[model samples]
Target: MAERIFKYVVLGGGIAGGYAAREFAKQGVKPGELAIISNEAVAPYERPTLSKGYLLPDSPPRLPGFHVCVGSGGERLLPEWYVEKGIELILKTEIVKADLTSKTLTSAAGETFKYQILIIATGSNVIKLSDFGAQGADSKNILYLRDIVDADLLVETIKQKKNGKVVIVGGGYIGLELSAAINLNNLDVTMVYPEPWCMPRLFTAGIAAFYEGYYANKGIKIIKGTVAVAFTADSNGEVKDVKLKDGRTLEADIVVVGVGGRPLTALFKGQVEEEKGGIKTDAFFQTSVSGVYAVGDVATFPMKIYDELRRVEHVDHARKSAEHAVKAIFASELGETIDAYDYLPYFYSRSFNLSWQFYGDNVGDTVLFGDNNPASDKPKFGSYWIKDGKVVGVFLEGGTAEENKAIANVARIQPSVESSDALAKAGLSFACKI
Candidate 1:
C-alpha cells in the first residue's frame, strides 16, 4: 500500500493565489500534485507598486519591465518557481466553470481538472466609470488604472498631453496616491470627492479632515463634497472640462477614475454564497462547498472588532487570511479541527510627504486621542479610538518608530479608565485638548 497523493487546483495568480501556491509547496505538496491556473500570461507579481513606480514615465516601456527585480540573482515570482517547486503552472488559462458537487473545474481551453481541494483567490476588477455614463461624455480623456496595462496606457496618454490637468474621481487610498504622484510630476491635479472628507470610510472624520489640509498644502486641489455629473469634451474628442453636480465646470485634460473596485467572482457566481461583493466564508475561509476555500478581497468573514462580518481588501488582510486558510486545510486533512482565524486588521498609506498607519478596527463609538489641528500648520498627531476605555484603533501621521510601536501595543490591550490614564501619563495627548 502506498500513500495516496491528493490533487489541489488553485485559480487566480494574484497575490492571494500566488502565496497560497507557495505555501502549499512548503507544506510538502509535490509539483505534479498541485496546479495553478491563471488567465494572466505572466506569473504573479506585486501590484502595489503599479500605481507608483511602474506607472511613471521613466519606467521601462514594456510589460516585462514592470516585473519586480529581486536580489543579485534577479529572481522574481516567475513561473519557473512553480516548476522548481514541483507545481504545475498553467498560464494564460481561465477557469470558466466549476462543478462543486463533483469537485471539477473546466477551463477555457476545454480541459477539466478534478481536485480533492480547490482555492479561489481571484482578486478584483476596477469598477468602470462607464457604468455611470461619464465614459461616453469624455471617452478619450477618462482612464482607469487597475493593472499594469492600465498604468502603461495612462503613462503614454499623459506624456502626449501639454498643460495637463488631471481630475481624480475618488478619494480612497489609491486615488490619493495617484494624485500625489501626478502632482509630483508637476501636472495640475484636482481631486473630487462625493464625501465631505477623504478616506472617510477608512478613517474617522477627524483623521479624514486632517488629510484634506495635508493634500491642499501640496498644490493639489481638494474638491470636497462634490461629484462629477458628466464630462465635457471638445469637438476634437479630447477632454476639455468636467461638469459637476454643483452646476460648475472645471477644466481637465485627463480624468482618472479611482472610484473603487469589485471582487472578481463572476466565475463563481451561483456556485458559491456571496454577500456584499464577496464570497461568504466561515472563519477558516471555507466556502459552502466541501474542500473549496476562498480568501482575499473576494471573501468575507466575521470581524472580532466590529462583531460583524466584513470584507477587507488590504494587502495585509489578504496575506494574513490566506495563511490561515492554508493552515485550516492542513489540519482538516489530518481530521482535526482548527481554531477560528482572529487577527486585527492593519493598513497604511504614503502620500503627500506623509505616512499614515492604522491598526485594529476603526468602527463603533470612538473617542479621539491626540491633537486636532484643522489649520494644518504643525505636523499632524496620532489619534486612538477609545471604546469602553479600551483602545480599538489608532491612526497616526509622520511615522515615528516609537509612537507606532506604542500604538500597536495599546491596540492589543483592552483600554480601561486606569489604562487610559496610564497612556495619558505616558505622554499620549487627547484630541479634544489639542
Candidate 2:
C-alpha cells in the first residue's frame, strides 16, 4: 500500500473543507505542511450554488466562478491556488477507514495517509427514499443534489427533459430551491412533503403560506401532509410516476428527493466521542481526542450563545467554524487562548425574485409583520421570535443588506421585548433601532 504523511490533513471536500484550506493559507502554513483529501473529482467549491444559481435556466453559474470564500464575499480559491500555495489537493480519493489512535486514514484505494493533526469535515449525506424501503427508489433521473457531480447530472437532465414534468420529494431547502429551478426551465413542477408546510422545521405557517401561494401563482403544485411511498419507472428505468402515501400518483419525468441529511461520521464511530449525531467537540472544536478537530456539519460543538452543544448545518456556520478551528489550532500551538465559538445561527435562501434571511433560534412565540401577500407587486415582511421576554430570533423577506445585518444583530443581542403586539407593530423599526 502506498503511504503519505502530512502535518495537517482535512477530510471531506465540501464547503467546510474548502473554507478550512483557505483559512490555513491565511493563517500562514508551510507549503507542504497541509493537505486536503476529498473524494470529489473536482476541487472544493461553494455547495450552496448547486441548488441556487447553478440550476438557473440562464447562463447558469459554472465552476471556478463559485469556489471557496467567494460565497462568503472573500477571495476565491481556484484549484491553482492550492498549487501556488504548495498545499496538496487530493481529489477523487475516499477515505474508507480511520484509525484515530494511530492517526492514520485508509482510502478506498490501497493507499494510507498519516497525519499529526486531522480535521474532520465529512459534511452530510442526503436521506434517500431507498433508506425507507420505498419501491423503485433506485430508478434513473431520481436525483438528489449534494455535490458537483449530482448538480452536473441534474443540469444535463434538465436540458434533455426540457419542459418535462418534475416531482419534488421533501419540503426542505432542496425541494423549494429545486422546484423553482426546474420551474424556470419551463417544466411542470410539483412538490410533495409529509409536513403541512414547507421547511416545517423553520418556516412558520404564516411564512410558508406566502411561499406556497407564490409557488401556486407560478403554477407549481404542492401536495402537503403526504409523502412519496414509491416511484414507478419507465422501460428505460427513468422515473415516470410518483406514488404517494395518500393514494395519489403524479406523472413525473424526474424526481428529486431532499428529505434531510445526516452527518458523515460512520468512519470514526467508535474511534471518537459523538453527540447530536455528530462528532462531539468543545469550544475550540477539538474533539475528545487530542490533535483532532471537527468542524462544519460534522461537529456538534458548544453553541455558547445558546449555552448548549449543537450542530449547525448551514453554510455560514461551516465557513465560520472552519476558520475558527484553524485559528484555534494555531493559537494552541503558541500556547495562546482565543474566545469560544459563539455562533448566532444564521440561514438564508433565494428563489424566483424572493429572498429571506433568518438568524438565531426559531423557538418561542413568533410574530409576523409587514406585507406577505403573494400577489403583492413588492412584498417586504419579517417575523420575530420572542422567548423569555427577549427577541431570540428574526426572519425577514426582501430585506436590504443593511436590514439583514440589523436583524442578525437583533438575534445576537436578543434585545428585550415588552409586548408582542407592540413588537409586531414596530416591525422592522424595532430591529433597526436595536
Candidate 3:
C-alpha cells in the first residue's frame, strides 16, 4: 500500500510563493505531491535588492534565497532538490483560474492540477508612470526598478547616457534609493513627490524633513508639494520634459517611476474580499475562501497596534507572513485550531549614507524624539505613537543598537511616554529633538 500524499500547489514564484513552497516541501511532502508554478521562466529571486545591488556594476547577480536541493557547491537551489523532496517545479506557467470548490487549478497552458492545499503569494507590482503620465512612460529612456529586467534596462540606459538628467517620481524608499544610486553615476537627478516630505507614509513629518534635507545635501534636486501630471516628449519620441501639477516643467533625459506598489490580487478579484486594493485576510492569513491562503503584499490583515486592518507591502512582512501561512497549513492538516498571527511589522531602506529602520504601526498620535537636523551625518531620531498614554508604535531613523532594543521593549510593554526619557535623554544629540 502506498502512503497518502497531500498535494500542495503554490501560485506565483516570487519571494512569498517560493518561501511557502519551500516550507511545504520541508514538511516531508513528496515531490509527486507538491508543485510550484511560476509565470516567469527563471526561478524565484530576491526583489528588494533589484533596485540597489542589481543596479550596481560591482554587485553579484542576485538569486532566490529559498532553494530546494543542494548543488555541487551547495549554493544554488537546484531542480534536483525538488525532485528529491518530491516537489515538482513548474516554470513559465501561470494559474489562470482557480476552482476552490473542486480544489483544482487550471494553468494558461490548459494543464489542470488538483491540490489539497493552495498558497497565493503573487506579491505586488510596481506602480508605473503610465498611471502618472511621466516622461518615461513610453520612452526607451524611462525605466522602472521592479524586476531584474527593469534593472538591466536601467543599467544599459545609464551606461549609454552617463550624464543625462534622471527624474524620479516618488520619495518612497525605491525612488530615494534609486535617485541616490543614479546620482552616484554623476547623472543630474531630481526627485518629485506630491507630499511636502520624504516617506510621508512611513515616517513622521520631522523625520521626513530630515530625509528631504539628507537628499538635498547630496546634490539631488528634491521637488516636494508637486505631482507629475503628464510627460513631454520630443519629436523623436524621446522623453524631453515632465509637466507638474504646480504649473512647473522639469527637463529630463530619463524618468523613473517609484510611486509605490499595489497588491497583485487581480486574478483573485472575484474570489476574495478586497479592500483598499488588497485581499482581505484573517489573522491566520486565510482569505475568505477556505483551504486557500494569501500572504505577502497581497494580504490586508488586522494589526493589534493600529486596532484596525492594514496592508503592508514591505519585504519583512512578506517573509513573516509566509512563515505564518505555513504554520496555518500544518495546523489544518492535523485538524488542530491555531492562534492568530501577531507580529510587529518592520521595514528599512538605505539612501546616500544613511540607513533607516522602522517598526510597529505609525497610525496614531506620534511623539517625536532625537536630533532634527536635516544636514547632519550623525543625526539619529525616533518616533513613538501613544494612544491612551500607551505606546503602540515606534519609528527610528539613523538608529543605534540601544535604540533598536528600546523600540522592541516599548512594543512589548506598550509603554507610557513618561516611563522612558527617550526624548530628553537623546536630546539635541539626535535628530528630531522635539
TM-score of each: 0.87, 0.99, 0.88
Error of 3 at 136 (Å): 7.9
lDDT of 2 by residue, 1-434 (tens): 76899999999888899999988998899999998999999888999999999999889989889998799888889999999998999999999999999999999887999999999999999998899999999999999999989999999998899879999998899999999988999999999999999998999999999999999999999999988999888999999999999999999999988998989999998888999889999998999999999999999998999899898899998989999999999999999999998888999999999999999999999999999999998899999999999999999999999999999999999999999999989999999998
lDDT of model 1, residue 92: 84
* lDDT value, residue 176 of candidate 3: 84
1-434 in candidate 1: lDDT tens per residue? Answer: 22223388777777676677667766788658888777877776666766666554454335444332331123455666778888877778878887888787777767777889888888888887676766455458688887666776787777777458999989998889898877877789999989878888777787777777667878889887888888777887788788888888888989898888999888778988998779999898999888899999999887765677889898777767776888889888889887898867777887655787788767555545455464555565666666776667777776576767666666666454445555544445432222
RMSD of 3: 4.5
- Count clashing pairs, candidate 1: 5
lDDT for each candidate structure: 0.74, 0.93, 0.74
- Tell me the alpha-carbon RMSD of every candidate: 4.7, 0.8, 4.5
* Candidate 2: regions farther than 4 A off: none
Deviation (Å) of 4 in candidate 3: 18
The candidate scoring highest on lDDT is 2
* Candidate 2 accuracy as TM-score: 0.99
Off by over 4 Å in 3: 1-6, 64-80, 132-136, 305-307, 419-422, 425-434
